[model samples]
Target: MNKANPIRIQRYLSGVDYPQTRDGLVRAAEHNGADAPTLEALRGLPDRMYEGPSGVSAEIGGDS
Candidate 1:
């Protein structure tokens, strides 16, 4: 899914600043209904996708 999509892994964890640790991201992803393994996979994605120059990018950017 697109990184900036509110329902995607990035947006779901963006509120917590892209989580410096896996556990943090997992918790955030759970709130968005992501399964544990899915959350772990998403957490391993590029940090740039989750953290923006500001907050979550207003634009979703290009495809992941």
Candidate 2:
């Protein structure tokens, strides 16, 4: 949570679409158990960060 980056907060709330309502963003953070900083990083992830059916495939396959 780089308290300096408001954009990160905005992105985390709205998703890639548009600025989400404040409440929506708050709920999302709560549901995901994400700290403000972690949520900010997730929001900053590149669009292609996850590819494939569930996005977990890459992580799962990494152990093989």
Candidate 3:
């Protein structure tokens, strides 16, 4: 998947907890009412524990 807009991705992931895995973030984003694009972008994230929003954003190749 290509890089998504960091700001938009973060918006949907606003309620996420730190140190969450990609699957966890997906669930959080779904619960937070993320749209298809946002969800798709999140699903594209690496399958690893993200320390924080910054880490997620960085992995997506965008500045938070």
Candidate 4:
């Protein structure tokens, strides 16, 4: 699940810039058609800078 999740998350972050804050990632994901689970996970993320999906994946318990 972890392995596949990042791949799915990537689809929503393809055009987003790196080093995004939690809010930025959520907004970006929403703009790119992220689903409820994705948005919920983003909302639960820590308030900090993130380089890419890997960091977000880790927060959601992915093996990043």
Worst 10 residues of 2 by lDDT: 52-61
TM-score of candidate 1 on Cα atoms, chains taken together? 0.39
For all candidates, what are the clash counts?
Answer: 0, 2, 0, 0
List of clashing residue pairs for candidate 1: none
TM-score of each: 0.39, 0.30, 0.86, 0.77
Off by over 4 Å in 3: 62-64
**lDDT (Cα, tens digit) per residue for candidate 1, span 4-42:** 433454556546764244456566678777755556565
Worst 10 residues of 1 by lDDT: 53-62
Which has the higher lDDT value, candidate number 1 or candidate number 3? 3
- Quote the lDDT for 53 in model 2: 20
> Which runs in model 4 stand beyond 4 Å of their true positions?
1-4, 62-64
The positional error of residue 31 in candidate 2, measured at the CA in angstroms, is 1.4
Per the 3 Å backbone cut-off, how many clashing residue pairs does candidate 1 have?
Answer: 0
List, residue by residue over 1-64, the lDDT tens digit for candidate 3. 7668888888888877798999999998898888888889888877889999889888887553
Q: Candidate 3: TM-score?
A: 0.86
